[model samples]
Target: MRRESPHAGPLRALFRQFSAFAGVGLVAAVAHYGALIGLVEGAGASPVPATLAGYVLGGVVSYALNRRYAFDSDRPHREATWRFATVAGVGFVLTGLFMGLFNGRLGLPYLPAQVLTTGVVLLWSFSANRFWTFRP
Candidate 1:
């Protein structure tokens, strides 16, 4: 049998976790953008409020999925939920700021601004959740 590298197992595990995280994030993004679009287009709601609502829905979906799949933490639901909400709360503020800057101040389209904001928030979520919210 061939010898495997010492670092391979941990690397593979990390990759798997990241893949799961990304998958969950994709689902969350669908929820977020769907609500945003529906509220803004169908209900004629303003972008900021619509985005906030969408983020809340998406944050719920993300917390459930990430806790179960991505991080696979055995932490109690109460603790994990509180930690996840804290991170998400900060993320929401950042999202609003970025969206306001990109869409409102910069005069970019809402869709593009939201897309950019999502990317930025994705990084923040992954880092914060990995380090604090779902720490192993």
Candidate 2:
């Protein structure tokens, strides 16, 4: 057994960062799903496009919250914003690809597919944002 201290500095920091990030993600997800459901059920938009739109809305929210809340980054906006967008662009593509696979091909319902997609994207987004977008 290789047990280690519970309060190890780096490990604890990572856990705290991820916890804050997940909290912000929840708020961002509301914006995302709100747009998705509204467009799909109310406006008759297809799930894919609706979700894409929602992803954009959520990305904006995520960036705003995550910079300070999750990462406590002191990076200037001029630099950080572009890095954030770059990471988000990759996430957007992943979102579309996974959504298509899950819903369009696998025949899962749109909401379920979105939930899966969110989990996948969350890992990518957190890593990229932590290492690149908001690095201190």
Candidate number with greatest lDDT: 2
Model 1 TM-score (2 dp): 0.92
lDDT tens per residue, model 1, 74-105: 98888988999999999999989999999889
Per-residue CA lDDT of model 2 for 44-120, tens digit only, reads 99999999999999999999999989999899999999999999999999999999999999999999999999999
Name the lDDT value of residue 65 in candidate 1: 96
Give model 1's clash tally. 0
lDDT for 47 (candidate 2):
94
Q: Could you tell me which residue pairs clash in candidate 2? A: none
Reference-based lDDT, residue 44, model 2: 99
lDDT of each: 0.92, 0.96
